[model samples]
Target: MKERIMSKDLMNKIDALGAQEYMSDAQLAVFEEHLRGEHERLIVRQQEITNTSMKNPESISGDEADKANAIQSSADARAESEKNKAMLRSVSVALQAIKTRDYGYCIKCGEEIGLKRMISQPAACRDIECETLEERKNKQNPAANLKIS
Candidate 1:
């Protein structure tokens, strides 16, 4: 009896996808745990800031200054929360890419992203070659640089 063989392209895609699935899922779990820890830490720090601000009421002569302090603390907490949430979103996107079996190829060049790159940054969308080109292009783009006149 002849042995059934898998197609080469299919096998390659499967292997790449499997590797990404494992790495992405494991990393996602780790990141979720880290996010929880960070959330707790942020809450504690925010509480401390709020408590300190409240205790310094004498420093503010009027309600406006107190309100300004409160607003600053709120904005700081919000920025931290936004950063954490954005990281979570990236992990979720990587997981979705794994599910779709589109995880390990350079989005711009349609080439396989190297294992080293994927291992280091699983959510990467470009291989080194394409990424380098993109970096060069961005560097050359006048609009990418901010100048003060």
Candidate 2:
């Protein structure tokens, strides 16, 4: 995945909004544009992964090592696709929140998620404290966050 590098001017603008206020119209516009760009980029990347996976066939008449490598590569591609899908979902949710005027607030605690955090991770749905607690809980009981078919 390509790393997102926030420009210094953008960071300064976000920082100037202060930590107390909810995202203003300008802030929301910035985030909305960013999320939209990410959504498109992820869609394109997913298509590329799907196309590549379709073009690459598993070795049917190769040495055991070659077969294993092919299997591993396929698995890796699948994992990456799944990750991209999850990110797309997150971006979608963030966009929806922006439309609802609930962006930059923690879903779990109903507190401002802070401009710094939002600027760094626009898809964040929780504040740092709540997020840390949730992460700890997930770590303590990983299976609780998983679904089985």
Candidate 2 lDDT at 48 equals: 93
Candidate 2 per-residue lDDT, tens place, 18-60, comes to 6634687878987898789889999999999998777454544
The per-prediction CA RMSD against the true structure, in angstroms, equals: 13.1, 2.7
**How close is every model to the real structure, measured as TM-score?**
0.44, 0.86
Clashing pairs in 1: none
Cα lDDT, model 1, residue 10: 28
Model 1, 23-63: lDDT tens per residue? 36554444334334444554566566555545443354668
CA deviation > 4 Å runs, candidate 1: 1-69, 135-149
The lDDT per prediction is: 0.58, 0.84
Candidate 2 Cα lDDT to native: 0.84
